[model samples]
Target: MATELNTPQNRVRFGEFEFDCITRELKKSGRVMRLEPQPAKVLSVLVHKAGEIVTRQELIRTVWGADTFVDFDQGLNYAIRRIRAALEDDADAPRFLETVPKLGYRLIALISSSPNSELEDANHTASLPSTTLPRLYWVAIGASVLILVLFLAGPAIISEFRRPSPQIAEPVSSIAVLPLRNLSADPEQEYFSDGMTDELITDLAKSNKLRVTSHTSVERYKNTRVPLPEIAKQLGVDAIIEGTVMRSAGRVRITVQLIDSRSDQHLWADSYERDLNDILKLQDEVATQIASKIGSHIISPTDARMAVRDVSSNPNKQPIRPLNIEAHDAYLKGRYWWHRRGTEAETRGLQFFQRAVDLDPTYAPAWAGIADSYAVMAHHGGLQANEAMPKAETAALKALALDDSLAEAHASLALIKFSYYWDYATADEEFRRAIELDPNYATAHHWYSHYLVFAGRFEQALSEIQIARQLDPYSVSINTWSALIYYYQGQYERSAAQFRSTLELDPAFGPFVADDLARVYEQQENYPEAIKEHQLEWTAAGRPKDGELLRNAFLAGGPDGYWRRRVSLLKPVGRSGIGSALQLALVYSHMRDREQTLRWLEYAYQEHSPWINFMARDPEFAWLRTEPQFENLESRIGLLASGTR
Candidate 1:
């Protein structure tokens, strides 16, 4: 509510709720509630108003920034709504947050900035109805004895009994790690929290028993106002892990709690603090405890000093070494940006990763990061395959040499071997090894799905992509690939619908999704829709289609003229990172011009274009699948030996 305290304070309690100003987190009855960033700021401003009614202008200046816009009223109303929901304050019967019509709002709940403030709160609530309680009131709800005994003797009583207590919850099969909130004063330290979240997820997922959700899947919940039960349900996870990371004065502290989402029950919670130098080891300790609580092995892996190191060739491999603190910090920042995706973000990520390796060349994860950046650059068509893949392979090889157990490095190596060298055998082994080491690694499964589809293992590909989607349900790339799998399998209607659904989730995907949808339309022989979708793709990509030219060509010679016009319109530039050569080949194959298709296919082969890997499975190329020249190109790509040709 409104604060009367004059001095600045780190934490304050108000009406059974605790607010951490630094972390922007609110907790009621010891349970964390989702308060969005905007609402948190509004609440903060109200708390600082010294119990006075905060006018609209005051709120706008303090919470919505100095630049006033036309929508400030709407934005303020939304924030107030969110704050009320989070605090469970009814506008009709306001208890905590209250609105003042024709003005702004006020926090009526008493704010306590001091430790002894609870006494003040008690005196204030004493005159209210029995329904009203002290601000610091601790209610023991359904699990009263468990709380009582825990306060007295704690969970240790379970060991005192011969049989397990009924209070103990069954071990959950799946869990999602919500993004760790950054409690540091500086906002730049956000990457530290994100990186810690990723590390914790990886550590717990190492357990052969646990099905941990991917960071990409849970990332959408960062600073979200959505309720935990709903978030957990969307993720399809049995339990949820929520936490905060605070860094200050060369010291780090992490606090985590596990919640059974279905019942909204707290299973276990703990906090750890250590010098910055030991942050990596501290992370491992937190993971170890959480793993134990989840009914998994007590020790998950090595020390951040804690990842893969095993290799059969070395019977007694040296234990993975602890990382240099600065390098570890840099590496965390690198991964945060990498997770952001897109060309500019990945480039920024690569620079940070380079800094990491320069600071500590022995850090295997940094080398893996380097491999990932280059590999992604190639995949995004930001760099040529020959240029990017070689660098990726070199870095991945170095990482493996340092610590062969790195699943991320192995996955990166696997993609390079398949997409670049066309070494199917080695790629197969690498992908398997990566998954075996970390079965919950969603990207490994997602990439493996691509290989399966291209190799004509439709059933296996479907299975793998399903698993990938399960682990990373919110990931756009995995969803896109899932749709493409259907397209490759000739399930046109399903693929079209899936692509549309994915595009709905990620509108930025229009440039790519529309292109794929165009193919589905073409396959269905829906010429008008196909042309419209293709035009949408071009316009979204900043290359507006010549609609009149396209329509005229289609009218003159049907699908054949339309495809010929597309070939003429094709630029030297690639589309959605696939080489123009491959795009041309697609057009020619559609026209059933075997000679032109073969010529462009050969060009794609010589360029080592990444899209060439899909030649065996792309339905457009089916017409030319029997041509001698196409067969020769496939043979060169090692697809013949693999039998996919």
Candidate 2:
């Protein structure tokens, strides 16, 4: 019955426009205007029921048919936009068609059949132009000559039009993988989709030849309506990958498309379906296919063979082991919580990672997750360093033993070596190895920069941190640490600016960043601002009363009084870990109380504080550089003599 409305006699006219149902043509003031087939069909339907409402469901069923597998809401919106464009209609003050809100659309203008008198007038006007036969003969002769010239040059003209544009020919070296859409009927499967997107980003990052944006940067666009080109520009990538993941029963399906950001062209697209157990192979295949399409140099056949080699003796080999379905599920859940970046989330993530390892003890990636969660827990003060760092180190070592080429395990080990064991040389070596295995691992770059900062290699630290910033521009931790690097280099203004930017990304990082900013403010002699920032830090950490007391103490007796009060407050927690003791040492140093400072430094060293590695170069300890106690502490910790800078 809908097909009958697509006939010529059903022509309708409204507001100086005519829609021919038979010819499916839209003409404005007797001139045909271009409209896509879908938009024209939509227009025909709306005009047929002029002055009446047409629901979206009715239009969808009529225009797209019943079983269309697309994002219908987005498609319908796009079609309506096209209709408005073609009709020269304003959606806000619509004259021809009016949107009926959530229902659909309606033709607001009155419609009528085309008058026979107007048709006769149009025919008469057309006949008048044909009366000049002699002039028409001369025009025909001129057109014949033009046609001959065109015939001789047509191939060249056609070739010029058909040639690929510059953007199409340009190689895609960088890409951002947008969060994959979840197509499962159950909302609980969102974790699976997000995890798949993370895995794809990780897989792509393995290609040293391609600069893949980190998942942290791309996760911002999960449900965004922004266009692809705009997102690509923000990520500074040559291309973008958008996809959907659907998990049903024991089978999983993934559909992905690679787009050229500059040209908005689809360079390649494919769909893969496999059992849950084979999902790891599917991920590798998708990554390899995408790398090949982008002309990346890392997808050669030799690299594939190398990826499958034994990694025990060959440290250069890539880890390509498949994961069990149960292990993969637990790993996904672990990562889902891990990205939240809070103490509770870290603890929950650790449990999932443990479950993953328990399900498949050979899964190196799960072990890496366990290591990361434990390390983060320690860093966030959720666990004592002595209790957490050893467990993190054990998990990292086990992961490396299982798969020597696992970059994440190597990075975890590097962090443990630097912070727990104080093995600077071994930490540096592990960091280098992790980066060599996966150059695009932003976390490796982020942590390596910290190592360089402690080693007093400020220039190298700045360079490495900038690389991390480029890879994960939106990562709050990366941005905060970048600011810290600037602070360590005594660039107070730069540090302040970076902290402000990090806060802008997410105010929830206020507690962490405000503490760092407060330090920078204090170093710059901005006491009032430092106190204010410290108060903000305390308030964000759910201790407003402490902040108020500290503020009062600082205002009452200046820096010396502030340190005395801070030291007194920290004394209780100082026994919990080296972090609190190190904090006390810093406060004592600021107070110029060499005795208390040395006492806390001894305690920190005895507890294997990570900050102990920075003592030789820390500006706070500059006053104690020549002190015998400080010298003895440095020597005991094996500080390089050249670290005086």
Candidate 3:
């Protein structure tokens, strides 16, 4: 039935364009235009049903076919984009074709049958070689045309015609918003300026036309004396935004400039002063103006309307909901501490987020931040799973209840589902939904990659992590996690290279990096390097004495003796938490002591350790796959249902 709708037509015309369905060619203003096959097919379908909504499913079935093994959504979107580009049609103010959001596209231009439809036939025929015409005759014809043009227009006309027109500047496709300088007399107000910078990045990132670098990558440049071009080069962006934020009493002023990084030229600059309560409005105005100057298409009709609305008269036009000054301040502080990523910082961040929600109960972002903090604390072993996961889920649900469109909330909930509930299917769906809502949200991609790796989908995991790296290239966590994914996939050399690259970015992450590298080297059977890396990890963790003892044990006993020493040391600390018990199990597995490995694994299961989830894919446990006890443990933990490596 869908094939009937795709039946070839003789010709189709809309606006100044004509498409020859049989020849699969397109023309505008009597000149041929290059349209790729997929785009041309998509255009033909939209033209066939000019005024009706062509659903995405119909387009996929018609163009891609139901059985095609491709990413249907991404492929269809690319095809539609190509069609819009060829037509010079704006998705925001479409004149020829209009997108129907969740539905497919529609041809908005009026279509009519043209009497000159034979033009395509004539053009095709002319493109063929004329065997009957001699070479001399063709040369004479070309000479006559040149003489006629010179005789009619003169030499000056020829020179003028040959002159090139002034070139238009290319649209900025990528940008980095540097940390806003705090110009307040009090230095402690740095949090306010940092918060404002983050807000502007968030607002600009919503535009699908622009690839805005994540806040984590840009934060490193705060107070640095790096040249604008150098900073732009490091961030790998076409443009840079530099600003100064000043606050006095209940009023704030922000001065910002958009610079062309290659030329160091000011593309646009402006300053805004408003009451602190109107800060959200000011941020929206700045983002809208910058996007306009950079020629970024408004992402949606709602965004377009909000951008053009007279905010002075109708403040509700601002996309960001209004927040009380105190609540906003607290939320910003929370985010600052959250970015630090440590037990103390997380605890402090949680307190500030709670304060923010207390001040403004309806603030969805604050609730989302609360959920993020709780999820991180639980995930990093800073808090018990039972104590932290429930609170995280509740806060994430509340945030979604307030604003279902918050990608951060959705991502936070997805993390909870993946790590705590072990609901792989639901977690995968939530991660996809979050990414669909905001493709630029790097955290979603980063976390989703981990989920994929855990599910033994290494190729998909690599794909997602690559996107996250592009968005936040210098993120230490993302870089390290990318290595971790490779490690799980058994790509030891690649995992080592990635870990080394991550250490180059932030050497302070040495301990974590060393731990991962040690495991990778051990897997490669490079025991010496593995032992050295383990020592480095221990020293970085502030246990030089333990490092020395471990090194001595390795020297005296080799791999077996070293692992036995590790198991003995970890056994005493087993009462502290399930983590030590799991570590002992892992060491026992490495020593090839089936009895000891099974014993500690049973202890971990009895303790209800969250680390039990890793048993399915952790290569250390591969040797125990045939064991009945291991199968039973994995089955009970729900990993068997999800598949194992």
Candidate 4:
């Protein structure tokens, strides 16, 4: 049955939204929505045919007409995606729109709360435009010659398929891959989706033509209700890639769409399905297609299509090898936990990585995960460096032996070499090699920046850290390093500003950077601001009483009393992040008690505090730079000769 609304009343309402066909306007709660002409036309057609199937070909003819030819499939899909975005609809469990597999689309939302609102004439709601109508100039042909005439039009029909898609736009130079939704509707499958997100980012980053935001950065938007343009702005990317992944039985399916961040327009969309065992090849294929669509990674659209076709025809193309699926699963689980960031999280990550290796001892990525987990554990205080560093080294070497091309393995190894072995030259080589292998690895840039800062190469460090920030702008650690490096270069004003900017950028990131900012204020001799920041830090650390006590001490006896009070409150170091010996050493350094400062430094060194390596770099220790014990300690750690290793 044909459906229609009162003419010029030419409007329909669904799910709190009202659409006017004549005006081509969509509004929610009286606020007009952005619905471009093309997408608006598509929506009008669907709304008029509410609760009915609109076949792909029928919609194409009605909307584009025979005279205005284009890549019909891509155009239609882009239009549908834009409409869905406007309606805030989900493809998997749509509220207003639904996809009819192998058929077309159906406007499933109740219109004007009536099912029998029908009057199907072409002009009922919004008549089809002339450009959308098919012309039949030779329709009077005789039956016997009709078949011959259609056969003669075969070339033209094929040519119709090659028309340029309207979705094409100016190529974007950068993009962020938001975490893919888990379409399995099972929480257990979240790891699979997250793992796929990481792999997609990794593969896309391989294109020198584009900058792919770090997975850690985009994961911040996984389930948040933030606006798309706002997310793009925060990520500082030209485009955004959002998608969904589903795994069923032994097969996996993924659907992704690219959007222009500036206009929130759907620029391109594609879907891929593959056997679970060949997921690696499937990921590479998807990445290649997306990269080509967004930049000059594949030269041109024609070249992109040919390259995809050649994946099967080209003998040089690598075949899809069977993966040790269980081991791969375990490795993914390891990564999922590793990103959680804490002593307990690292322990869980280590367990899963160990499980992966046990399942397949030669799985290089799994071994690399093991190395990373151990290395982080050391830094996070889950284990003493002396204990974790050796274990990290072993796993890193094993991963390297298995796959020397792995950028992640090289990075983990390089960090360990710098942090423990103090092999400055080798560490530099490894860091460069890791970046050369995968220039988009943000952690490599982040860590290398630290090395450069320690070596007093402030310009190089600033450049590397900025690159890291560009790749992972939302990463608290990466942002914090930029501030720290600035402080190391004696640019106190810049350092304080960076710290304050990072805090304002994400209040959730404030906790990680509050202490750093507090120290920066201390360097400025702004004791009041320093105390205020430290109090916030104490409160965030779940020590409100301690924060109040410190404030009271500052009120009573000024900076001297505050340091003395902190000295009394100092507790021996424990497992992980609690009760750092370095904090006490800094407090003693503030009091200018050389004997106490040296005593606490030795204690921090014994406890393997992650900050021990940078003891000499602490601004608070600047007054005691001439102390022999301090210089002797620096020499003992391989930082004496050139002050960096």
Question: Where is model 4 more than 4 Å wrong at Cα?
Answer: 1-164, 167-169, 298-321, 606-608, 643-645
lDDT of 2 by residue, 16-57 (tens): 787665445677887655454456657766765667799999
CA shift at 482, candidate 3, in angstroms? 0.6
Models 1 onward score TM values of: 0.76, 0.74, 0.69, 0.75
CA shift at 170, candidate 4, in angstroms? Answer: 2.9
TM-score of 1: 0.76
Off by over 4 Å in 3: 1-168, 297-322, 569-579, 599-611
lDDT of 3 by residue, 449-567 (tens): 97888888889999999989888888877888899888887788999998888888778777767767888888887877877787787777676776677778888988776776666
What is the total number of backbone clashes in candidate 4?
1
Among residues 3 or more apart in sequence or in different chains, the pairs in candidate 2 whose N, CA or C atoms overlap within 3 Å are 7-22, 8-22
lDDT of each: 0.76, 0.75, 0.74, 0.74
**RMSD values, in order shown:** 9.9, 10.9, 20.6, 9.9
Enumerate clash totals for all models, in the order shown. Answer: 2, 2, 0, 1
- Arranged by TM-score with the best first, the candidates are 1, 4, 2, 3
lDDT score, candidate 4, position 4:
37
Which residue pairs clash within candidate 3? none
lDDT of 3 at 394: 98
The lDDT of model 2 is 0.75
